[model samples]
Target chain A: MKEFQYKNPTRATWAEDYSFLNNDLDNSKLEGDKNKKSNLKVTDLNLYIHQHHILKNVSLEIPDNKITCIIGPSGCGKSTLLKTFNRLIDDTEGIRYDGSIWVDDVDIFDKKTEITDIRKKMGLLSQRPCPLPMSIYDNITFGCKLHGIRNKKRLAEIVEEQLKAVGLWEEVKDRLHAPASKLSIGQQQRLCLARGLAVEPEFILADEATSALDPISSKHIEELFVELKKDYAIILVTHTLRQALRIADHVIFMYLGKVIEAGPADEIFNNPKEELTRKYLEGAFS
Target chain B: MNRILKNKIAAGMMFSLTLASISLVVLIGMGLYLKSAPIFKEHSLWELISSADWQPSSGKFGFLPFIGGTLWITGIAVILALPVALLTSIFLSEHSKPYVKKWIFPALDILAGIPSVVYGVWGILLVVPWVSEVLAPHFVEYATGYSTLSGGIVLGVMILPLLISLFVEIFAAVPRDLRDAALSLGATRWQTSKLVILRKTLPGLLAAVMLAISRAFGETIAVLMVCGNIPLLPHSLFDSCYPLPALIANNYGEMLSVPMYESALMLAAFFLFIVVLIFNTSSRAVIYKLERKFQ
Candidate 1:
């Protein structure tokens, strides 16, 4: 019920600022503010999986406080690109990336970067909901406990706040102590989102978070993401162009592991610059 | 018509096989019960189990000392072996390098395959002498060459390979996505293992430990050689004691010459079988509950 502000300027702002909504129509006006700090900057990114190049030389600046959807067909490196933001791809053996991804003015790929700290700054939702094998309350507070929040009242409040943020509190308010695996697939994904948000991440990196959910649940999640972008930058990887058009403020179309075209959603949809982008948007092939 | 006849034949054969195995166990249990019935008729069950005296000439057939000795030695072995096995399993499943796993796995398999008699010979040559010479003089006063401590140490070593293998398999069976989910939340590797993996596989771990305990309870030659078979309640770890299996192994040959001795020994065997049955059933129950929870 009280307003909360981030003490650190580099952290995502919790208060909703809707000024970006007014400038959504004009692509040139938004692009003119290039001097302003972006949430993330990728420079000459190239990813290789066991000597096979997966992503070609790619560079893009993700604007702050916006929903940027990376849309592409299967095996187009969209998920790989999304994973690189939180360094989840590092878990794969023989994965080599020659690029610099800067988040909050720090190079995440730098040798001196603390991976735990970098991951804490970004929340990740995988394709399927993989809740920790625990009670719902414990799932939400796992990251908080790892970060040294030991107070019971504080933990209970955090569970409520995060679950409410993802619209899971009302549905699961009475069964907070139930096992997370007992929930439906839709509820489990929402609980995963709540668990991710409990860490108070500045960015939400979702890889097909709604692909496994029903249409109603997917609609709820899409609406939640639209509201979330006002406080945190959301970078999503989705194969559905309809979902992208419904939620994405900025869109990047990738083909064969390369970014073909990227700009404001309206501009890319109305006036096509590249033939591949136009064909892909027109449903020639997915 | 031929296919239906074949199917009926196969079904009848499978049913008969199942019945044969169940009847075999029932027949063996009935034989043991009949052999031990004379002792139970002569003395009260409580007195046979709780009385401490074992004077055969005076016709006192107490079994408390053997039961106590078995429990003591098995408890010590479990305490000594469990932590080591858990650590070894965690290393093998999560932390081992590929080359290390390649060598250690076969070595562990070989250890598991070694005969109990070989372990008994090895313990007599090495572990018994070390306990008597080095440990007894320093830690205990007026201790003998054979002790519960020595036997427990040997049994602990014998069960380690089995426990480690079971634990490693359980840890390996944890789904990869569960671990990735934990790590993506910025948890350290140890935290993920302790908080997520361990919790998920707890029932399996318990089953493994129960299996090891059952094996230790029935272990014979290795325990016999080191336990010193004194047929008395041990006052300390350094004191000599006679476990139930050792008592049966040592005195079964003389059963025909003595009256009621054979029946008492049969009763001991029956008691041991019951204990093992309880352990196995509980372990299976835990696994069953775990599977049902997940489903």
Candidate 2:
């Protein structure tokens, strides 16, 4: 059965679509040739969730088009830090934060900077594979359709491109109209990735995105992040230090809501560093 | 007793209890069918249901007027209640503060706990006059204080809390992650709710609505008090109509002297029983399928 049909959004509607999918991302095929160098500059950001100081005064710079891995134990505000970039935490009740995350001089926290615009620039993959309750083809095009890509042929092309991008087309091609929740966990995660990619976000924020998958699926995602680092600035929050070591270009070590160490992956993993970082690497408290 | 043997005994006990309940439903259905058999034997079932001539002395029992009235009131109740109930439940489930829900749920519970007789009295005291004096004047030429419009209004109010409670539960059961996925894709809050959460909960919402319809269909006292019991072919909202529940409730106790009348009433009960049975069972099946799918 045909599960999803587009209502041919007019050009005016497309113009007013959520940030219009950033036109430059359409032609961003070459490596190191991205139009904008949007490095997130988090300056002394303090967060309080339900009056609990969840994130201490945290400051860091996330480089453009690189895999930045946030490594820490559970409840260390790694996911919290990741959420602040897109202002997803604003939806949380009793959450108050004073953070100026400048995305290339445009502060995300600024009232003038539309929150949807800031969010459209970044993709999020949460801990679980959450397919929007629709068919496989619909799930992949869910974000794209919202950005007003109404041409049926173009939508089909996008669904094919994204599904193939995450290497899921061959597996799911025959059943495009099937419910996405029917897919296996690994396939569902890849579908989520493809859905996010359809939005053409410059940054991919993955919060333990592979923790729920099998080792093979976990490996598959790890390989994808390394490949996707060329086109998107990939931010990964991982509890597994080995995963951080394997794919991170830059590593951020956080302990109890504070960044204990931040540097190149090799430098942070191999060399002498902060005592807390070393002890964390040594499995002192987990 | 040995622990495993004790566990076996407990399991056997629970299974038997469940079986008994299942069989009891079957038994009730069979009993109604059998009791209503005499009337169907006397006249073809379709002939009896489709004919509007419901004269008792001449052995002519056409039940179309009562069925039409039942459908009319229920249609009104659904149309009035569904939109408001669905919207309020969505608000309660998604947008309202927990404290707001805390007071509202209890208030709804109290509304639900109030007896049907009280609702009928309230309809008689307020809604009937309001329909005749306030609402009907703008639309129709003539309308009695007691009419299908009043019955519908009362039945709609009676089912609102029931519908809202079920709808809220359905919406609340949807995973928060679905909403998270939508918003993360830069969708607006309304878009996320409508496209993702609402779509996911659509089946459950429909099942709840069907359950509400069955409840409205069989509601006797409230509908009877408001609906004028003049078993005529209902032409408009303001026309007096006699629903099946009202017919059986109005005549069953006093008219047992006429065996044919008793048989006719039994058939009406059978019709309601079968219709409600289909609604409840089918809705339950839909809910069960939804549960398995999400799980």
Candidate 3:
């Protein structure tokens, strides 16, 4: 419960260090400039979930190798926006969308985006830890098998490497055959993180990945995210302002399905811009 | 009485009821063993188990043929029923809508409630003639009213609804999370069913099948009507057969010789008791295995 402010570096501090903030506030201009370079972009994105227009004309550049944190209040369409990237929301009953989500220079919604390959490129983690009722080794190696990586030796190596990467290798090395759910909640969450990362995805989307864990677990996940961002660009949706401030390199503040504020994490947290963003940071409304 | 005394009284009542039921079961078992001690002494366990001759009048009472017939019929019934029942269960659990499930499930319950006598009568009147006239020409060439296949098939139908409904309940009890989790892992719908859902609920499904088999094993009237009550080993589906229950029912009325009759009946009952007991114990063991696995 702390009050935080995000300065619109585009509006203020238009100096040498903050020159990147001069991109247009509207998404169309931002996308045109960014998409000519990167492979993924949200172009004039609008997401209407059921009767509620969850995201209204929201767009952002999800750069190839940079972490983007979607920070917002509950039900602000942060997770909804992330789900749209992989067309997961399409599985739901009554979702209607009118926008373009392009991945790897191809419009993903263009009737040609194979969900399997799209999902292969982008691994996802939910808020709760979901290690399948399988062995620790198998849980980590499951997605690899799905992508047709059947070489057992290679799978064993990937399991070891991913577990080590998530800092869970030492704790579970000897008991790789043990059921993944037998681990503590913290360990289970890390196990799930390892599962996602084992797929070797270029982009990892975590929807409040550590929200259901204890503070210690949350801290470990945050550290893992920082380490992970070095390799895979992360799109994390979190309600925790402190979490966003701690790890997010770039922050997009969403409210009522709209981007209330967007800027670098440091500028967004330390300075003032939108009143809704400020109030949200101050714990005015969760 | 104080609260503690009241609680103790309640506990004691439950303990007494449990004690009574267990005692009754033990007494019945003991009584059967004691009553059949003459047969066990005269005929060795191997003779009782392996001998095929079932002539009780001259005291050459080998219950093996009846036991074998019982087993073969039950096995055939289960083999026939299991696939049909399992497929029905899967359809009900996975494919049927809520309204269809609600109505279809109760229809299955009504099938369960239909008496064995009705099934027996139906098997004789409706099923027997159909098999003789329609199915016999291509296969048996001289089909009779009583055959193992007819008995087993009718018995299978009788137990099919029970097995299907129990299977549906078992499969339905599988957690939605297990399905969703597998699906989200990029597994196709069929893969999810085959891998996660089926694997998780295998123990329950196994228990259901075992119970159905147990029911099929002990069923009497239906088997009696269709089994063409010959005491000989059936070579094919068209041959006459005699399962234990049919034998017991056949001989019980005209069995005037005391020791011969008593011993035959006791041996048959003993055989059934052992079979049912084994099935029940295995069912419990499966449940225990499932619990331990989850734990």
Candidate 4:
């Protein structure tokens, strides 16, 4: 796999400074700029399903305006961690969680917190694009309508802006009224991204959003995520190390449902402090 | 050699089964056409269809009154049943808890399995009297204890189980991923149902309603017990009327004594068959379109 060159020259100096650190680096210091508001803060999140611990004492801080990729092998609770951002895990039976996740300084699990409001602040993309069975225009406008955007001109502008953001406007501009199911799988994923962005969410949670797509489509979606990270905080869960390396601004490594290592993407990829992170990144076991 | 003989026997049996079902429909259609031919030959088809008088002894065999009555009863019954069945199905598939579904499903299955005759008796004992004593005098001056409205309400109740079950199946068949996609976008449950689930399952819902309408059209004993079997056009909900099923079921025996009575009865049966055939065919077309759309 090809390594992505860092865009910022200062990041190289920071990586060099952290290169000689022992395996047990202080996690808070490595997170960078503690005074800045974290996009998402997890204090100590422990999740269990029917007495089986799925995630144990996981703590991390996702910086604002960056793509934070959570990478782990199968069944490592990567997807579970992403779902907690939007509270999508609340629907599952026999699941219990201790600790809190705060998004934009608001604890999502607060007793008085409204789930719909929390969900509104985030957009979620699944492994496979699941578009509502409707026209392309309607798919883009569905979230807007739910948020009470009823003006025709505003909806049309939103549709154009969202589709343009995901680079789908030129391809599907002529047939906005066509059924969304008529699109190719790659086009469908882009359309789903457009649909998610239509809500103007402050955060985006993508759970393996490109695994089902072809290589070209995967690249297109990765580029879109990189572009989107400037305005919204994006958290992606991927098992593909190459994908995490290609687009992640920060990388979180998990093993057996524990955060083994987490830091700037270049440092985590070039000089991983934990033995598990090194072995897993060296293609020993995925 | 033994296996070949067994396969041959199996193929022959399957072919015979298919042939038997097709021949049954052919036989009924032929019988209806042949028996009703004399009526059409004696009086012009238009006269029998357009004339209001239906006296058997004097040989007037107009079917206009019965046709009007059939339409009125079936239309009213569908209008009464559709909203109730849809709401019940939505609750069963989406809102109801597991324990609630456990109790409701078996109750509905039992209601569906109950004989239509029991519904007839129940309507006569309960619905008919209630309409007359509670609803009639206040609504109309000359309301009868047995009227078109009573028959419609009875047929509506009788078909509720069929409609509700079909709708439940349709609603449940909507892919879970679609619902998740909508809800994850911050849509309320009602919005998800209306915008996503309802649009996806529309064809199946239409098919269900058409099937229920076909059932209501062919309902016999229950409709007869409550419909008053009056061979006249119903001017109001409180007026007595006769649908085709009740007309045939009530008067088929009289064909043995009266001239041209059997022919008239056979014609009514033929009309009922045609109406049901149209409904079933359209329902099938809708389902086919739905499948093609998905593909």
Candidate 5:
């Protein structure tokens, strides 16, 4: 129910500049200097899964090279909204959406668009730890193979770099040829992080990646997110308010499928504008 | 004090029942081994193991042809059934819709429950006639016999449901996370099934295949009905065959002639027992190894 277009100012560099007008709230006014560096824009987004509205008229701007954390209660549509960024919900059965999700000025819902390119541009790490039934080395190179980079030396180097980037190379460097399932739970989660970064995606979506991990492992993943935000924009959906405060630069607080309040993490945590947001921060409700 | 002793007595009674249930097989095995000793002594293990020709009426009994026949039929049947059953399993596990799977899966379960005697009757009246009358003449020219090929084909069909159902169960037990991980990495659906799921499930698949092979070897009625029950070594698939189970079935009742006939038949029983015992032991060993490895 919305229109999307691209504006090309240079031959190689492109930007997605979106504007929306509504009688309920004028979103175009929120489109300030911040919107100029946005890689993706969500406007009037609505999602229905089996006749249950999961997201309702949501609009937000995801800036470049920043970690945007979505904090909400369980079943509050944070993960569902994350799935829309790369169209991961397309494979979900009996799901439908009425929204325009734009990436670099291209409407992702266009029939001519391929999911592989979108998936390649964005890496998603799910809540549960999943390592392939393969060697740790092969897990890192699986993305390279999918993208048809067959050079052996380059792949080896990339695997090493990504492993080192996630701070797992020291523990697993000696056992890189071992099956990833052989690693401990904390180690496997870090291996999955390295696997995600191996593809060199511009954006990373983590759906509560540290929920199943211990405190030390949780801190390690938060540190990795800090290091990774320098080169990639990361969108994290977490039910833990403390987790969001620890890692996020910007936080979007959603309750019942609508954005309750969103701002810089410091302001949202120290001085929440909405009552539900304040109650959620105080642990009155999840 | 009396009530506590009664409860302990009941617990001990149940424990003994569980122990006896497993010990029953060991008792039967020991009894069979002892009963086989006289036959082994009269027919000198060399004669039974070396000679290929078996004619009880002439007082010469050898187990080579029957053992060889069992191996040949099982080998051929596995060759025919394994690929088809595995492919069907893959389809059921990964491709079929939920409603279709619900229907098809129960149909396979029913196939596993079908009686072996019914399979025998079908092989004799249906498969043997079809092979001899329809296919043999075109290929062999002088073929007037129901061949080992017919028997093996019938046995293969009989074991198909068993192999397929076990394969489906194992394939379904593979973790969905493994499949999702592969698919999320940009591997196509088929690639995910082939490379990740199938590779991870290989040890279980191999165990299923071995169990199927043991079942096929121990099968008596179906192979006996269709194999033509000849006593000579089969040089070609077109020739009639006599396997160990078929020999046990065919000669056990007709050995009223000399007392040595009983000994010879008992010797064949021992051979069949040893083969089955070896298979069961090896299957358990391999499955144990796989369980430890995967865990």
Candidate 6:
């Protein structure tokens, strides 16, 4: 097997070229900025499937421009909440939502709201990387093309820009027209991230995005998220405590379909206000 | 140790049974070749197929009409079925609700279950009249409606259930996540289907079409009844012609009275079997290769 290597390009070089990458905030500046406004506001959100309560009155304020890891045991509705942000799994049979998720001060579940229009605001990285069944270049431009960006030169630039952001351009630059599925699993995940970013969303919702990747690859993704948080609100769903502690600036802990504790990463991990949060953090029940 | 011996015995028996099934196919091929040997000795294979004269009285047995008719009918049938099948499969798999699909799918299965003879009867009653009375007068001077066009229509309808079922399976096998990946990018339902799912399943779809074509080739009773079985070249869709299966069916019982007739019919049967066998095997191979590549 060939050894895989790609440069993690500096943000300074990226910032000079792209308007979106202009924000380069360190920890203190991001923390200062978050206290002013939450990017997403969920109010009295209750979800049910076949008359069984899945999320019970789930309400939280997800901070803007920060990495907020939703960590809890499996089936605790952490993933369900992440999906609720984009209304991804709401179309499943017998699924009913009795809540409002306000993105940009508009209720997303309103009958008048167009689902596709709102979904464009957030790019979701699912548990397993699913590159669209297309060439690598087409995969990046697919989302842009959907939004009606027809200029050939512009599409080419967006493809190169997104790929370089995720450190995939150097590796896949030669094989731009090759099928995206042909890449290594680690590389495919990066390609998917690049694809997600090309759509230019304000928030990136990842549901255990690195769970399917090897250590080096997961580390690669974590580093990408750290760099990306300056410009995009990065919301991650994870069961791994180590990962949550590693990259999360803020943490939202949920258990039994309820938010147990929500605050800064150290505040939740070090001095948890709730006993359940402390126990969960201490590996009481994963 | 005793259980291990029993397990080995069972494995050995299963393996031999598998080998037996393969040998059965070889046996059939050998049987077909041997039965058709007398015809090979009588005429050169090229002269046998390419020549127009098929008179049995003078020992002439050209197969051009039957071969041409089969090709024309099959070509027309596939052209008619491909778009309808693709659209129907897409509708059932992507657009229809579960309840709608639940209702539609069993109907297709029931369509598959009905005998070909029934389809032929229906074709004679409805399609023949429709083509003769309503369609042919505009283009041609006269048509009996018992022509290649009628056979093609009936054959296309007959192959519908199989094509739809295969296409539906192919479309449905694409993971929901891949669709969601496209949908989340703000792509509409049709765009997602066209760019993602349809493109991904092209190889399997090709395999399915090949399988349906083979099935269409060997369809005997339905095609024979409506085709106005005359051993002549079909210059147009409305012209009467005789397909290979129809040729074998109409001539086999009368073959004993004529010397070269039985050999000629056997040769037709042999050629049909070989063509169908090659198509079936190669289509299966394509589908298998596609499965391995995707996985």
- Which of the numbered candidates is closest to the native, going by highest DockQ? 4
Name the docking class for model 3: acceptable
- Model 4 reaches an interface RMSD of 1.8
Separately for all candidates shown, the number of backbone clashes (residues 3 or more apart, or on different chains) is 0, 0, 3, 0, 0, 0
Error of 1 at A32 (Å): 19
DockQ of 4: 0.54
Q: What TM-score number comes out for model 6? A: 0.89
Local accuracy by lDDT, each model:
0.86, 0.85, 0.78, 0.86, 0.79, 0.86
Cα displacement (Å) at residue A37, model 2: 1.1
User: What digit string (tens of lDDT, one per residue) describes model 4 on residues B85-168?
Assistant: 988998888777667888999999999999999999999999899888899989887666698998999999989999999999
Clashes of 2: 0
Each candidate's TM vs. the true structure? 0.88, 0.90, 0.81, 0.89, 0.85, 0.89
After aligning candidate 2 to the native by TM-score, how far in Å is the CA of A187 from where it should be? 1.8
Task: Output per-candidate TM-scores for chain A, rounded to 2 decimals.
Answer: 0.86, 0.86, 0.85, 0.87, 0.85, 0.86
Error of 1 at A281 (Å): 3.1
Candidate 5 C-alpha lDDT tens digits along A1-286: 0221222111122112112211335454488764443377788899998789999999987756667899988988998899888886765656888878888677778788776677777777888888877789988998788888899999999988998898888998998888888998888888887887787777888989899999998889888888787778889999887778667777799999999987666667666788888878877223
What is the Å distance of residue B137 in model 4 from its true position? 2.4
- Which of the CAPRI classes, incorrect, acceptable, medium or high, describes model 4? medium
lDDT of 1 at A251: 81
Q: Tens digits of per-residue lDDT for model 3 on B67-181? A: 8788888988999999998778877777665678879878988998999999998899977888788887888668875778788888999999989988888887876545544
**Residue B77 in candidate 4 has what lDDT?**
91
lDDT of each residue in A1-286, candidate 4, tens digit only: 2453434331235454344333345454566764443358898999988788999999988766778899989999999888887877875656799999988778988988887777887888899999888889999999999999999999999999999999999999999998899999999999998998899888888999999999999999998998898778899999787788778877899988999999888778777799888888878323
Q: How accurately is candidate 5 docked according to DockQ?
A: 0.34
lDDT per residue for candidate 6 within A39-58, as digits (tens), equals: 58898999998887899988
Model 2 spans with C-alpha error above 4 angstroms: A1-34, A284-286, B284-295
Worst window of 10 by summed lDDT in candidate 6 chain B: B286-295
Give the alpha carbon lDDT tens digit for every residue of B95-174 in model 6: 88788988998999999999999999999999999999899998899999999999999999999999999999999889
Error of 6 at B192 (Å): 1.6
